[model samples]
Target: MSKSSIYLPAGFRFAGVTCGIKASGKPDVSLIVSDRPLVAAGVYTTNQIVAAPVVLCRSRTPSSTVRAVVTNSGNANACTGSQGDADAKAMCAHVASLVGCDETDVLVMSTGVIGKLLPMEKVKSGIEHAVAELADREEAFFAAAEAIRTTDKDRKTESRELELGGESIRIAAMAKGAGMIAPNMATMLSVICTDASIEPKEANAMLRRVARVSYNRVSVDGHTSTNDTLLLLASGTGTPLQGDSLCLFEQELTELAIQLAKQLVEDGEGATHVMQIRVTGATNDASAETIAKTVAASPLVKTAITGGDPNWGRMVSAAGYAGEPIEPAKVSLRVCEELIYENGTPLKFDAASLSATMKEHPQVNLDLCVGGGNGEAVYWSSDLTTDYVRFNSEYTT
Candidate 1:
């Protein structure tokens, strides 16, 4: 698709620039500003040891409106103690001064190496340059997406336009993530904007629900980052959405989030295949998700898929230990359309054929039925490869 297809919602401007935080000297800073106060809500990483920016953002999230977001990639402002906290506040303060808003009206996010301090001199210069270059255009949005990347192979962006209350409304989003991914949020940063008018209470509720099924259902290496943040902003520049229109907007938002989440898995560090794990027949949705996550996060299962080996036993074993009761005789499993296990017994199937099928497709489907219950859930994960090990081993260098 054309890059311009990822258009920003009305009244938003974006800029991205290099701040010398990355050794490669790629763009490492991004600023997003709204023309007016917008309803905002955010979901952050649940990690106990949060980054400085996470702490700052969490403190201001109680407010109903926000005007700007400042983010940087490389040199995560984490574990610097009081200094890190001060630096995070300074970043917001700088943005607020330039945008003519209170410090609380701006949010900050940073990602990259942990336990390092931010280069305040470079950051100040980068923020000033970014603010000066801000513009409402596709190129600006693309730059903002690119500046938020640390190890991502590609920039992730999505947009949708729909008519609400006889007026056109647009929703656009951009995200950065490749590794350190798991449930309870991932090692990622994302910003979503819409021109539809929405109240703060309703917007927050909608974002939480959307995240549970999208960002919360993806796993790369079963690791949650300290800097994960997902923010949603509503500019109120379009006709107000109510009742069915609000529901429609939420549905579209969920779809867009899912699209970006899937992209993260597809672009996972050294990932060759994306696995869609669907668990059904459980006693409840929670049980189903627990089983699916167990299978999706198993290293053995991930490695088997990476090598195009149709080793269904590993998957079955992972599901059994998901802390949920399951009858061996009632369990059934399938990889794509080929049945590998039934009635708790391994079925005779052509291993070569299944392996070939896996090699031919970038996506692999694993369906498991544990019981006759009505609960069902789905999760996405990436196969583990040798390169994933090598890259992370020397990431500090």
Candidate 2:
């Protein structure tokens, strides 16, 4: 299928450039421009050391619209104090001047290592070149996608079609991630462009719901990034999906976003298996997520999964430590349809056979039952690997 065929409700253009800020000389800057102003909404990382661009982006939304988005990979421009904020603003000012829009109408994002200053000069020149180079072509989208990479080995994107307000709405999204991906919003960076005609309120609501299920459910190292960002912009180009018609649009958006999010998780530093953890029969939905994340984030458990060991005790104990009050005696755990533990006790299953099952597929499911309730949560994650440690140990060098 064509890359742009995902979901685009309006007209938009993208550009990317290589600025030497990152250690690698590949592309390190990108531009996302709407043909016109777009109603936009964003979600940022909970990290205290928020990036300079993130702060500025939040301030300019709601009251004002956005016309251009400037982003960079390599230096997060976080924890750099006032100077960082100025650099972020300068990036926006440069883009706004090129696009002939208000500075408030321009947004900026950054990713990669933290506690670093943005090479403003390189970014400034890059933005000038990117603006003059913008083109409404597929090659531009692919190149822009590449320009935002940090450690990612490949570019990731997804799209879907839905009928809203008696018209068809197309939703297309792209993301870059490879490490520091334990989500309070992962160290991930993304800019989703849509052609759906959505108001700011509707767009905000949709973004909230999507983040909870997509970005919120993915983790790699249980560490949030200082520069995490996920922004959605509707250019009002495609069919206008509103009210109940929005239900289908929301579903499609969440699904595509989740698909992209999962792809990033699976591609984590040195991930080999994509594990899906489902916690059911919890006291409430919140409790279910607590349990799921606890089990999913356990390095010991993740390593065991990667080694193809059906260590049921590790899974059960991880849930036990999720901080949610649960009756241990009533807990149950399963891996890929094989009941490994029941009533908090080991089941009569062949360990070698189960280990074989775990190694046979790239996907593994951990089903946990807290008993007596229907609350549940499904999360996407990856197994820990020694290679993962080696990759990050010298990432800065």
Whose TM-score is greatest here? 1
- The lDDT of model 1 is 0.91
The TM-score that candidate 1 achieves is 0.98
TM-score of each: 0.98, 0.96
Model 1 residue 111 CA deviation in Å: 0.4
lDDT (C-alpha) at residue 160 in model 2: 71
RMSD in order of candidates: 1.2, 1.7
Q: In model 2, what lDDT does residue 161 have?
A: 69
- Per-residue C-alpha lDDT of model 1 across residues 70-153, encoded as one tens digit per residue: 999998898899999999999999999998999889999999999999999999999999999899989898999999999999
- The window of 10 residues in a row where model 1 has the poorest summed lDDT is 1-10
lDDT of 1 at 271: 98
